[model samples]
Target: MRFRKRVLLYLVPAFVIYSAFMLIPLLMSMRVALYEYTGIGDMTFIGLDNFQRLLFESPYADRFINAITNTLEFFLYTMVFQNVTALLLALALTRGLKLTGLFRTIIFIPVTISILMIGFIWTLILNPNIGVLNQFLEVIGLEAWATAWLGNEATALPTVAVVNAWQYTGLMVMLFIAGIQSIPEDRFEAARLDGAKGWNIFRHIIFPAIIPIVGIVTIMTLMGVFNQFDLIYAMVGSTGGPNYAVDLLGTLFYRTAFGGVGGQVPQMGLGAAIATMTFFYDLYVCHRHALY
Candidate 1:
């Protein structure tokens, strides 16, 4: 009993810090969502009016729905492109190829860089006129394939999603590589001895061994997608321009709580409500996954 008490005592400091930074602020945000505040005046007790306005009222409702749609679409894109690419790369790297360590280091370099810097660099690279991508296309006599990647509404969100995937895919690759390497070497030899090769070996041995890691990666990707802000903010402004094609929950919350490009009014109450909903949604997803 004394040992358990000492262990609990050691954890108290970290728990207090977490409560101070994360739990307390989350509760405050939920409380703020029940009031009407514009950052300057006194907060008025408005009950669930902010949430109602966000979900059922005009203009706000439209924007909320649009943000939800875009956020989900972004998640889908990352899940399909980012995670699959990581799994494939991890499988290849685990095969004892030459310069495997060098390849892994090179791939993970982007993950070590600042996300804001990644967004900024990609923005320049995707620029319509002077960007490397368009210039390369032109040099190869495929100029028609190049266009304003970030400026066009049809391509903005997907382009941002791709850039995000590119930046984070390396992290996922390292994770998958770890999972693959954890499998016993005897398992691979046995499969090979039984004439299993290529896809057969992966399906029977490697994939099953990495199932737990796959689940972890999926949950991490989901949480990361929902909480995404910095990359989008750096690449596109809080307005999520190009006709709001890339507007996400994070940008919506920022635009509401702190006003956008044009001198728009700050709706702190509505912003808090949006944030509260997003928080609950993420919590629910995590809870469901935990239960399963």
Candidate 2:
């Protein structure tokens, strides 16, 4: 009873802090979503009007939808790219090769850098004028591939997703390595005895064993993608560049709720609405994952 009381005392303050900072704000944001704010006087209590306007009436509604779609696309691509690259890298590096430690260090080094710095580095690499990527393409007689990657409407989001994958794949690789290592060697030996080899062993034994890790990584990647704002903001400025091609919920909420380059007045209520929607979407995804 004494130990229990002590643990409760320790947990109480953390719970209070979490409730104050996170739970309270979340509830308040959900409340804001049900209102309409005209940016002048009292916020009118028009329940669900904000959601309707965002989904139906607003001029920027298409942009909002596009941002959501872009976010999903980015998440999907990054999930596949990161997981596949990480798994393959793990498999290759686990073969008891020389310089394995050095290779792992090199791979994970970029994962330690900030996403903003990673964005800036990729920006330089993919810059149309005097960028190394473009120069290499030109040298290889692939000048057509040298177009402005981040500035092109068709390629901006994809370019950013690829850059994100490049930065985080190393971490994913390390995680996959751990997961692979945790699989008992006796299982592999038994599989080998049963004629399982290469892709057969991977498909039957390795993949099933890693489902929990994959689910965890997927959830993390989903949340990261939905909230991704800094890298896009840094690379293409607040506009999300090349005609808002790289926009996502985070950027939309910021621009709508807090004003952007055009000096739009802050509409805290609308911002709250956007945030609530994003929160619910993330929740739904997470719940679905849990169900699965």
Candidate lDDT (C-alpha), each: 0.92, 0.85
lDDT of 2 by residue, 1-292 (tens): 9999999999999999999999998897788767666456777787877777788875767878988888888888897778788889999998789999999999999899987888788889998997899999999999887898987899888888888888889888888888888999999999999999999999998889988888888888989999888888878877777777888888888888777787788766777888988888889988998898
**Candidate 1 lDDT by residue in tens digits, 1-292:** 9999999999999999999999999999999999999999799999999999998999999999999999999989998889999999999999899999999999989988999899889999999978999999999999998999988998899899999899889999999999999999999899999999999999999899999899889999988988888998999889886888999999999999989888999999999999999999988988988886
* TM-score of decoy 1: 0.96
lDDT of 2: 0.85
Q: What's the CA error at residue 88 for candidate 2, in Å?
A: 0.9
